[model samples]
Target: MRPLPHHRTLRPDRRPELTLSQPLETLAFTPWPGIGNDIWETVAFPNEGYSYEVWTSVTRDPEATGGLRGGVTVRQGEAIIARLTCDPDTPSQSLDVIYDLKESIGQCWDFTSRSWQTSCG
Candidate 1:
């Protein structure tokens, strides 16, 4: 694992917002076994000693609106780091999500990557 810089600081009360520390262009999604229309993808940062796993589930609207809904969860080990959901009401073009890993924005959430800079955990 890479050593954290000594000059960095941490605030116990805050969770850090982190960006992808390394380029993730090569990551690919694999179909989740026995789960139709569900897929999972994972990436590891050996130098940083952490991995990110994302699970996605897609479902078509039952009312035959010809729309779709989906949910996604991002995790690091046993810890759930982020979550996202989309439905007919959400724009299909694109969705932007920001995870406040620097501050405790809600339950089951905390920053855990101080090496990126401030309080990542």
Candidate 2:
């Protein structure tokens, strides 16, 4: 996990717009070590006036003696706005990352809060 980037001023004064680089694609959780039992899910565009992709992936490392970790990334358009990377050694621990988006922003999962939190540039 990484420290979430600080917030940027919102353009609430500007009307929210739907300007996609491409037709929004269906988001899926694809694991890296694609083996053993794993769990994952994705949610896209959960809010009005914003397009967001949120997903999580969970897996157990056999070599780590049942250690579990999950990685998730939240993206808008093709750019990643936030990421959740589990600590390799402490697989159970996760960190959330937030990025800077120039004109748009949305919400992403915060493992610490175990809930969705606002994110912005």
Best by lDDT: 2
TM-score of 1: 0.31
On TM-score, the candidate that comes out on top is 1
lDDT of candidate 1 vs native?
Answer: 0.36
Off by over 4 Å in 2: 1-41, 45-54, 85-121
Residue-level lDDT of model 2, residues 1-121, one tens digit each, is 4466554444668865443333222222122233456544444553343445544445554553544454445565656667655454444432222212211245443555444445622
lDDT of each: 0.36, 0.42
Clashes of 2: 1
Candidate 1 stretches with Cα past 4 Å from truth are 1-17, 21-25, 32-57, 60-66, 87-121
User: What is residue 28's positional error in candidate 1, in angstroms?
Assistant: 3.5
**What is candidate 2's TM-score against the reference?**
0.29
Pull out the clashing pairs in model 2.
1-95
For model 1, residues 1-121, the per-residue Cα lDDT tens digits are: 3332233344678887555544323323232233444232222332253454433333433544434344444545656554555444443421112122212333222223211232232
